[model samples]
Target chain A: DMKVTQMPRYLIKRMGENVLLECGQDMSHETMYWYRQDPGLGLQLIYISYDVDSNSEGDIPKGYRVSRKKREHFSLILDSAKTNQTSVYFCASSSHGESSYEQYFGPGTRLTVL
Target chain B: QQQVRQSPQSLTVWEGETAILNCSYENSAFDYFPWYQQFPGEGPALLISILSVSDKKEDGRFTIFFNKREKKLSLHIADSQPGDSATYFCAASEGMGYKLTFGTGTSLLVDP
Candidate 1:
C-alpha cells in the first residue's frame, strides 16, 4: 500500500519555541513537499525537496525550513513559533516518470502556537 | 500573488445535483491543472487533473473542462453526494507537479 505518515498529529508550542514536523512516505517517492493551509489564503507551499539535501523554496518559505536526508523522510522546522504560524501542515510526495505528476498527501499536522 | 483563483467561495447544492467549481490562472506558463478535495481536519487529496494538451478529462462522475486560450477551467461533479461535500482547490504548475500554486478554494456543501 502506498502511504505517507506524519508524526505529532497535533502540537502546541509557546512563542519563540522551536517546532519540528516530520513526514515519512512508504512509496520512496523522489520528491516531497511541505505546505500550510490557512482559512482564506488556501494551501501555500512552504518547501519542496527533490532528493536528499536538495530543496527549493515555495511561495511561503520565510518562516520555515525543510530537510530531506532520506528518500522516504522529510522534515519541516520552524526556528521560532509565532501565533501567525499556527495552521495545519501537510506533506505530499510525487514521483517522476509516472503517468502524470500526481501528488499523494499525508493526513496532516495541526500546530498551535500560543 | 495568488496566481490561481477560485470563485463562488462557497456553494451549496442538493444531493444528486451537479456542482460546478471554477478556477483561473494568471500565468501562461502553467500547463498542468489539478483539482484537490479537502475535508474538515484532513489533508487535500488529488481528485482529478488535466494537461494543457487536453481540453476535457473525465474520471467517473468528475470532469474537468479546460480553455487554454482563456486560461480558465471548471470542475463538474455530477450527482454529487453528501460524502463529496468538501473544500475544493484548484492548483497549477509550470513543469509537471514539482512546484504548485493553489487557489483559495471553494467550500462545497451537499445537502442530502
Candidate 2:
C-alpha cells in the first residue's frame, strides 16, 4: 500500500535540545516536503527536496532543517528546540511532473517544547 | 507576504446546506489550484483540484470553481454533514515541483 509514515507520533523536548522527526514513504516519490500546521494559521511550507541531494527552502524555512539522503526517506531536524517551534509537523511526497501536484501526507508528528 | 488568502476564517452551516469556502491568490504564474481537507489531529488530504485552463471541476458533492482572471477560486460542499466538518485549505502552484503556497485555511462546522 502507498503510505507515508512518521515516527514518534508525539514528542516532547526541552529548550535548546536537538530533535529529529523522521518520515518515510513507500511510494518512492521524487519530491518530498515538510510543513508545519498551527491553529488559525494554515500549513506553512518548510522545505522541499526534489532528489537525494537537491533541497530548496520554502516560505518558513527558518528554525528548521531537512535532509533527504535516500529516495524514500526525509528527515527534519531541530538544531535547538524552542517553545515557539511546538506545532504539528506533516510530511508529504509527490512524484515528478505537473500531474503530481497532489501530495500524500503522513499521519503527522506533534512536537512540544518546554 | 502571504501568497494566498482565505476568508471567513470559519463557517458554520446546518446539515444539507451548502458550505462555500473562498480563496484568492496573488501570483499570476499559478496555473494549478487544489483544495485540501484536514481533520483534527490528522494530516491534510487532497480533496479536489482545478486547472487554469478549466473554469470548474467537480467530484461528487465537492466542486471547485476557478477564475483565472481574478486569481480566485472556491470550494463548494453540497449537503454539508457533521462528518464534513474540518479545516479546508486552498493551495496554488506556480510552475511545477512539489512546492505549493497554501492559504490560511477555513474551518467548517456542520451541525446536524
Candidate 3:
C-alpha cells in the first residue's frame, strides 16, 4: 500500500531546544511538503520540496527548515523551539506530473514546546 | 490576508440529512479546489475536488458546486452519517501549481 510515515508521533521539548521530525513515503513522489496545524489557524505551509535539494519556503517558514536528501524522505527541523511553535506537524507527498494537487499526508507529529 | 475562507465554523446535521459546507477564495489565479477531511488526531485526507473549468463534480455521495464567476464553491455531503463527524478544509491552488492555500475549516458533526 502507498503510505507516508512520520516518526515520533508525539514530542516535547524545552524552549530553545532543537527538534527533528522525519517523514517517509513509499510512493517515490517528487514533491513533498511540511505543514503545521494550529487551532483556528488551519494548516499553514512551512516548506515544499520539489525534489532532492530543491526546496522552497511557504507562507510560514520562520524558525523552521526542511531537508530532502532522497526522493522518498523529507525532514523538518526546528533550530530553537519556541512555545508558539507548538503544534501538530504534518508531512505530505504528491506525484510530479498528473494531479500533483492531491497530497497524501502522514499521521502527523504533535509537538509541544515548554 | 486569508485568501481562502470557510463558513459555519461548526455545523450539525442528522444522519440522513445533507450537510452543506461553504468556501470562497480571493485569488482569481486559483483554478483548482479540493476539500479535505480530517478525523481527530489524524492528518487531513483528500475528500473531493473540482476544477474551475467545471461547475459541478460528484463522487459517491459528495458533490462540489463551483462558480468561477463568484469565486465561490461548496461541498454538499448527502446522507451524512456519524462517521462523517470530522473537520473539513477547503483548499485552493493556482494554475497547475503545487502550493495550496487552505481555509480555517469547518467542524462538522453528524448526529445519528
The residue-by-residue lDDT of candidate 2 on A9-66, one tens digit each, is: 9999999999999999999898999999887778898999987989999888999999
Query: Which scores greater on DockQ, model 1 or model 3?
Result: 3
Tens-place lDDT per residue, model 3, B1-112, is 9999999899999999999999999999999899999999898999999999999999999999999999999999999999999999999998858999999999999999
Q: Which stretches of candidate 2 lie over 4 Å from their true place?
A: none
Query: What is the DockQ score, from 0 to 1, of model 3?
Result: 0.87
* Residue lDDT tens for model 1, B1-112: 7799999899999999999999999999999999999998778889999999999999999999999999999999999999999999999998765888899999999999
Q: In order, what lDDT does every prediction score?
A: 0.93, 0.91, 0.95
> Which DockQ values do the candidates obtain, in the order shown?
0.80, 0.80, 0.87
| Model 1 misplacement above 4 A | none
Q: Give lDDT: candidate 1, residue A38.
A: 79
Q: Which pairs, if any, clash in model 1? A: none
| Top-lDDT candidate index | 3
Best by DockQ: 3
Q: How many residue pairs clash in each candidate?
A: 0, 0, 0
